[model samples]
Target: MLGDELIALLGDRIPDDHARQWLADRWVPRFYATRPGGARVVDLGCGIGESLDLFRAHDPAVRWVGVDLEDSPEVRERTRGDAEFLTFDGAAIPLPDASVDLVYSKQVFEHVERPRPLLADVARVLRPGGWFCGSLSQMEPYHSLSVGGYTPSGWTTVVEETGLRVVELRPGIDAAALLVRRLLGMPAFADRWFAGTSPLHRALRRHPRLRGGGPRVHNAARLMVSGQFAFLARRPED
Candidate 1:
């Protein structure tokens, strides 16, 4: 099987954080490198707009448009003046054809009930040669509130069918690291361990070998087990 095929077969079982960071590390650089000067970009299914904030921090000049089904109060508060957010109807997106230079999405496709039409919409809004860089889970637990659909050939086939060409495709995060972080409650430790030099950070860092071991292990184990997928594709310049 191909790399993406392997990931599609096994991504969900891997750790979530491992998957998240893997995507962040890979796509952040690509976005920074390819982001056109002062161009408009769209972020679909931008949960809480944290990624939008990251994109803005990377390049403040770019205009960002964010969309999601529901907006939490915290998300609303943080997203204020940062980007434009729209509550979308399930079928149609409120955007013009060939208007955006890039459309970034993460973990959004799997939940879409009508994936084809949604992707067609994505293609409709993207300008020629524009790109769509994002990640989606393959093997994962089902949260009724946040449903995901994993199909190895689905994304590529869909994009090609929509008349877009696959530019670059890379393996995303694995599942093991995700599980460990969740079990360890690392999100709660974000401010404590990751942000500053706290005791927990020192403890984890001192063990040098232990510091970044989870993601590495997760990446390896995911290739062995099943549940991870990520890719970047683009529309032809035509």
Candidate 2:
């Protein structure tokens, strides 16, 4: 009948609106808990070192490195102390082979013109069993220097080509709600739209037919119409 009614039919297949499924604050804490105090982390396309700060907040001993295309004024003005910043030619990362334990990027892939070489470098810089994790746009509006976004399959293909196996993919906020926020000029209050508990999700949760499936089906159901997606890829152990 209605959109929500239709989705409700896919009971147990609906994605959860929790922090773990959404990869928010829950992720950094769990990641650092397992990592060594001096674990090496690289933030690809880091903008003003926000993720680095998050990592350091969890484990101050984390060796943080921020990488971007150029040393922009904003980065120079804001990013300082503790973390190291580096620039690359967009394809090859400047770090040494297998140097990092974690490679983190956030909302930055949508702007990249070429991702294969960059992903190859991601694999190169990561130590064996290291992780490449981040979020990417799927159906969000065009913003700063936006090129194009990737679908779930498209992203998996490229990551797999680099010989890194994808272990996780979670849908972010639904596309319809994200469009609404953009249409409203993305007010500060509208930032809650990123919290994963969109109207669609709440409706699904309310549906009498909706049951808890598993992360696989739950994620697929949401990714079908999500604005963005988060992923975790791992380099195999030697």
Candidate 3:
């Protein structure tokens, strides 16, 4: 994801209309292009299921499955209308090998104790040439379960080590908004409170001083503020 406009909140956080727009404008357009027609999609660590719901709305013919450690009513209610829910044992996924056309995750990598095994399992489920893309924290504040913080370089190493080729890796930030937040001494608040569509926010981020250097300067600011990393990767076709 590039530019401030492409930065998106998850479906669980945003309103349904915004979620739909995110799928139409961001998610579907990028992820769907790599998979075949009627591709099977599975989301690992799907928290409340709204992301899958939005994806389903866009492509009804695709098979949608959401997997997590616990299957709770809240998740069930959120996902029941459009998708199937499954719970896993925190290790091996229950699905058949090579059965999924795309496997997606977001903000879930840090808690994975055995990241290689997790990626191996993800690779197992994906068809050759299929995609697995998600966002993860590069430098976020620690929560109880938070155990890893990875740089873009670290992600490239981990994914390739697990047999997935990196396609795109970039900073996750509303660049201008984050800078404003940093200046206001409330970087954390900006993540939750910044206006996603503010013209000034977009303009400041697109300014020459920052935009001209490409992601180098953009990501430097992101890392200082504990921003995130967004990656799109694939299982090898061979």
Candidate 4:
């Protein structure tokens, strides 16, 4: 599929709901909470390892693995032996095929110079029915060696090419809000990012049409203008 056909096909996968509460960027914590105990979860581009705390708080039974280009003193200091840490060459995940139950990433894909190899590796590591979920940059400005952002169509094409199915896509903060935050050089404004109370979202909340339009209408409007997006995809069951 190509062009509008592919876009329409992917659009169908987005869920419809009444509250539009899923627009919140809280998927990481919620995802951790919902997993059955003992789920093998991988943190792709684990950074200084903040997510481990969520695992500890939400689902202690998760077998956590942190993957990055190399280990750091901060990561070692923060995470210690609580979870295994591994390094990668940006092309492959070291885990065996079908070994991971869930792979979670956040604001990391934009740094990836090439995504296919790592994504294919994501597909390789995920067990049948396993999920890959994370947020990606869209209209945000450059930061921390940023490479590029992704549109909904761009995400669908790249992720689906790796044999994972795109299940849901939700918008994040508004583009203008994100850029203004960056321009003002204020970290305090960062709180709005995943907090789900960004300026545009606040405005949309009061809009009568969005208030009553249901999830599909709300999300379609939001995704068109958001600065970031989160996705949930699965490796099909064998």
Residue 209's lDDT in candidate 3: 61
TM-score of 4: 0.86
Best prediction by lDDT: 4
Model 2, span 104-136: residue lDDT tens: 988888988998989999999999989888888
lDDT of 1 by residue, 165-191 (tens): 655443443444444445666576533
Ten contiguous residues minimizing lDDT sum, candidate 1: 193-202
Candidate 2 residue pairs in backbone clash: 12-211, 12-213
Clashing pairs in model 4, backbone N/Cα/C closer than 3 A = none
How high is each candidate's TM-score? Answer: 0.68, 0.85, 0.70, 0.86
Q: List, residue by residue over 1-238, the lDDT tens digit for candidate 3.
A: 3323222311111122211001112545566665556778888877687667567666768788888777444444553545687888667888998999878787778777778887889988898988887777765556437787786666777788878877655445533443566577765656553324323434545666655544444443333333455667888888
Off by over 4 Å in 1: 1-21, 70-79, 176-226
* Residue 157 local lDDT, model 1: 72
Q: lDDT for model 1, please.
A: 0.60
How much is the lDDT of residue 85 in candidate 1?
79
